[model samples]
Target: MQIVDRLMTPSPDDADARRCPHDGTTLVSRISPLRSAVRRCPACLRSWSDVTTSATADPPARFHSFRLDVRPEPAAPSAAPPAPELSVVLPALNEAAALPLLISDIETALAGESYELVLVDDGSDDATWAVIRAVLAERPQWQAVRLSRRFGHQAALLAGLAAARGRAIISMDADGQHPTEQLPEMVRRWREGARVVQAVRASDARGGMLKALTSRGFYRAFSRLCEAPMRSGAADFRLLDRTVVETVLQASRTTPFLRGLIPWLGYETHHLTYEPRSRIAGRTKYSLRRMARLATDGMVSFSVAPLRLATLVGAAVGALALADLIYIVAVALWDGRAVPGWASTVGLVALLGAVQLFSIGLLGEYVGRTYLALLNRPPYVVAERIGDSSGPPPAGERRA
Candidate 1:
């Protein structure tokens, strides 16, 4: 057999060779885990091949080859990180300007706590997705979902909630109007066993007088009409324990009015009242038309009062018509007088026609909502995603 010997570049007697580079332990020649040809550091477990004996029959020739050091044992794969304790779900709509500061504020607010931020881009025309990507690169713990199109605020919030994977999830707007500073207090309440923690805004200065009046009015009307009790100032800014989050997702297939749904769920709830802050940048996505639609949805979803009121109106109109007809007929029969007021007859016909049309329209609203629910379409489609290492599976992805 051919005898091949190898030498290390530096003599082991030298300072560099004498001490282990990793832990300062003395280097020693020992039987390698592989075979007898390698030397290793006992402390660091790094091995270097000092000699190799070939199996070839070459008259016992001595061959000198360069020292071969086996690569350090492949590091044991790191275990996956634990799940986050809390998740902040922000449904963004063209709030690119506010994202940078909003993300910073959230990180600062949630410092020393294990939390994830879930950003849902509701098909923003602005650089909202781009900004989200940059933030994700810097903060790998956060995740984002981009919708195929603008699916409204409720749909976006649903998508974020579906994507969030923390023990407790907080849903809020991306405009920075919802204060991140209150997050800890929300969490504190959650820790105290509150399944639903609502952030109640006393007034929205940015929304102006008309919005405030309408908002207040809607809640007052909603409370009296619907069995589900909702506080006037309660909004989308709220915290849900994992149980509540899952319950909401399973319960709502269509776009849900969360302000109404949360109370309807009847979980142990706590409320925190705070003043609304101005947007960090950009205008509010909620327009007058959108607010009206939201109110309509809330009223329609939770209450059949409109339909009942329609029925009551029809009955009252019928009773009045019957009484009038009896008066006219009795007078005609008793006095043998012909009723000849064409204008009065025409006005009565018009009044009846208006009532009939109003009842039909109210009935149509309920029918329309039922038809939509029957269609069973996903509320929002996720076109793309980033940072899925921890968040839930893509909620209705349409991969490009």
Candidate 2:
């Protein structure tokens, strides 16, 4: 791996020194978990690697060969330490092809840093669990959580965050929408006293004309109708302070629209606008139907405006009826006959009927959601968790 800092070059004289070129501190070298020539210092958070290219590289970037010491190490003493400085919570679903590579990118970005990686497998039908196991086998710094079933993205993310053991927790996508390179900026902002660092999308780079128009309308309507003001292009890729994380877990609603819910926390939020990259693997887990459901969740979870909308429609219909009555009275006094037309009457009845049905449906949606929430169901159920050799899984967990 190419390092920007003045890393020590391999030479007979320098090799004997075995010290960090930037600092006079002694450098400890060992075969990395990935069996790479990745020389790093835990104290300094500085690293560089010597790698041999293979078919894994597309069209061969370079070619060489090297060796790694793969001898089994001795057992460790039984002791536990403090939590990591940062924790990244990745909610994965059918992202086996992209998880390992994303893990690599995250490692590279946080090279030598004291951080934990929490990968949550949100009930993928594919070999995602196998990939998670393989990644855990490669490194003890990573933790993987698997749910019993698909509990949707927000729930999966909450599960990961609840399991996270970091001072500063980050939530991102496993399919590569949230870039790993900007992690430093997020940390910097967090250290600057912002409890939340929101990675706002620069643009909705996908969707057709109709989709775009509908999305715009949805946000506009949501902002005006709902008590919570959702930022346009706000994304779920974000960092939450440990206090906020704990607070969220304590609040523990059965359903949470995290994108809107995070903002509702009223924390000191810092905005970091970035253009999202396309996934390096399969299609998005969120289909159009799922998107609509998410939108509905956001709308209903934050406000009772849908119910108010029914009231508004009822009032507007009453106003129209009053206007019609006045017109009929005036027409009878002027010509001894009301304005002739069954057509107008049929049209008005149809319009009123449709509006009333739609209003009832909207009201029913809120009631139905409230009913489900009242049931007090668990947001998610954990199937298993791997990695974190330091200790057993948290309370009420199943081992795999």
Runs off by more than 4 Å, candidate 1: 1-78, 204-206, 319-340, 389-400
Backbone clash count, each prediction separately: 0, 0
lDDT digits (tens) for residues 194-292 of candidate 2: 999988777775756666676777877877877556677776789999999998998867858887777777888999988788898998777789889
Error of 1 at 308 (Å): 1.1
TM-scores of all models?
0.74, 0.74
Q: List runs of model 2 lying over 4 Å from the truth.
A: 1-77, 321-341, 389-396
TM-score for candidate 1, please give it.
Answer: 0.74
Which model scores highest in lDDT? 1
Can you list the residue pairs that collide in candidate 2? none
Q: What digit string (tens of lDDT, one per residue) describes model 1 on residues 90-204?
A: 9998989998999899889999998999999999999999988888888886789899999988889998988888999999889888888899999999999999999999775
